[model samples]
Target: MTEPLPHPQLLLAIAALRDRALAADSLNALGFSIANDPYPLLQYHQALVFQQQGQSLELLCVSGLARPSEDSPYLVWLQRAVRWIATQLDDDQPRWLGRDALTPPADIAEGWAEWWPKGLWCIPLHDRDGQRLGLVLFLLDAAPAPALQPLFEGLWRTWAHCWASFARQRRLLRWRPGKRQLLLALAVAVALLLVPVRQTALAPAEIVSREAMIISSPIDGVIQSMQVRPNQPVEKDTPLFSLDETTLNSRAEVLGKEVAVADAELMAASQRAFDNPQSKSELTLLHGRVQQRRAELAAVKAQLQRTQVRAPRAGVAVYSDPNDWLGKPVSTGERILLIAEPKQPAMLIQLPVADAIALEPGAEVTLFLTAYPLTPLKGKVLETSYQAQANEEGVVAYRLLASIDGQPEHARLGLHGTARLYGERVVLGYYLLRRPFAALRAWSGL
Candidate 1:
């Protein structure tokens, strides 16, 4: 059988609708075209268009209306009914819907009599990929002609493509925050900055004796040799080191010879006193000279005895390699080594002046020794220097003394490591910005 050809006027209406859908610049404009532009081809009492929003359908346009009023009863019922309808339709194809054809839930069925016609055409709009994007409902007074199906399918395809493109563009655009949202975010940031945290600083530290006896050079002379090894245990009166006694011995020998000469001259002058009265006056001068020489000789012998230094108390000898001290000239009272008790260990920290933070006595300190970095030792600050002094490394730093909390086996004297010193609690912002602020103040002199 030959199918009747589409009327020329009807073909013109479909072309016009397709052009209108293609020219749509926005989702709203496309929705309006979908809802009202096909009136000439299919005489419908009203048309409604909806798009998929998450798991629900959102009504975008209503025929003959500039904008669908959200508060309208008809729209309210239609939104719920349409969501129900979308779930029932398994395939993205044009179909007819009637109250008798598919029984809706009680709530939707109650609104049908007042808001909808007894029968309507539901056309699902699909993008090129075959994914349903929206739905268009047409409430026609009479059944749509079979010839109109092809025209409607072509027009809906154009509408779906335009809608999908707009959707993709909307998703790509960034969401600009309103004034209230911005203020809320700022408040949250301020709150985070106000959180309290412990202020901490890291500095070089070493394990030292808490109450070690200082071993210093007794006299000004070159060191001859070390009597004991570094870190070797020593008993009281033990020989620790000795100075070069060559100069002292030579001085003593000279003084002794002078004393003997003075004594011999005195005896000779005494012997001559009996023979000649003039020699009696020389005897008194010679005797005085002998006494002065004897005193000088005694002083030299005493200094010679002091050249060999001994440990004043029993403890371990703490110092650098003995080779460093041999032949080194040392002044009187200059420290050379330490006689430290093994049990009395403490931490000595050299915090650089630039990194110095306010610290109180008894502040918590954690020591990470280079020898045993995995196991950290805990301690508390006992004292700190008021002024910055140049350390062994030539860095100007404040000296801090800390006592070990417990006698840890690894807390051996002379061990070097880094110390993390924790001071008073402060706001997180202040803790993080303290160093930067200090640098800025120093640079700006303010």
Candidate 2:
């Protein structure tokens, strides 16, 4: 009696079951089926995927044909087995089927019982050109029938070919370029090569003298009025502001009376001293009184001056906020304004620390203003700070002063511009620009 080839329907059912299990998205579900199957001598199963960037195989999935438990001996052995296989593949050894088997330890069956009770099967996934892409490992739940080998092998072959074709298509898609893209890339490469780099120059600068004065009141009084605004330019002795001088005037009157009395006394003592030398003591005392009165008068006059603030120089007036001024009856030592000389303009250039180190007091530089790009100003480095300051970009640069030959017609303070420093220049032919493209071609194997 011919045992009808294991019923075709049964074979179809078995194939479908295997396919559905393999297609499971979750490893836990796959493990459940492998565990529940009544296959003794069950061992481990794993899948390894190739990483193109690292050019190596890494474990993608793992399952055991035994119960899941942290203390399971099989788990430890399986890990060790995977490690051994990974080492072999990483070295590109011929012992591992030359990348044919995705799973590590290409000879899975030989070392299977050493780690577990049963053997394992490793299937390699390849592309259409037979390039290895990944691997799959399976542990038997039972001694798989000799007949099962052919069935499983056929299943692996079908999936392997499909995966390979898909991989080949992906590789081809990456290399394909559209017309617009090709043109845009070529344009960028040409621009990088053809554009001439410009040289940066330093700007001019000058040193200006500065001074400060403290304006205090001799008499306590309320603020009468403010005569100057912040940043109002004023010349030396110019009226900065005024204060209420009523109290000061009263004190001046008292001091004047004392001075007059002292002067009369001194005169009488001097006449007496001339008539009689014995009255010299009284004369001496009178002279001392006169000196004291003179000093008092001088102090009164100084106090009177405090009532009116004045500029000490022909510069811009700088006014400080009232809150910052130390509490006093009137503004004391408060900056009213700053007067800067507009005729003498200086150029300030901030250069990177590295570049600044190369610059000297006489180094020449060219300056260009953002507003007037047509005009290029020449300047000579006059001074550089010993210390470096951090610019807005957080890069440390040295502040340099340069003297511009002639200020631009529309030059203004706080203008934005770039300074080009003429460093060593190199001469190269225009055709040499194509070197980068050639190198890229070699790298891409195109």
User: Model 2, range 1-446, lDDT digits (tens) per residue?
Assistant: 87336657657755765675566444334334333331322223443332222445544434432334535665545555655554544321112232322444445544463543343444555555656655555543343555555555555554555455555666777997889999999988767766554333343322221233444443445556556655556678887656677777887788889989998988887788888988788877888888887888788788777767666667654446544332336444443345555445556777876444256686776777787778866767777788898877787878877666774554444456776655323223233433565568879989
TM-score of 1: 0.60
Report lDDT per candidate: 0.88, 0.56
Q: Give the per-residue Cα lDDT of candidate 1 at 204.
A: 97
Model 2 compared with the native: what TM-score? Answer: 0.48
What TM-score fits each model? 0.60, 0.48
The sequence of per-residue lDDT tens digits that candidate 1 reaches over residues 348-376 is 99999988989999999999999999999
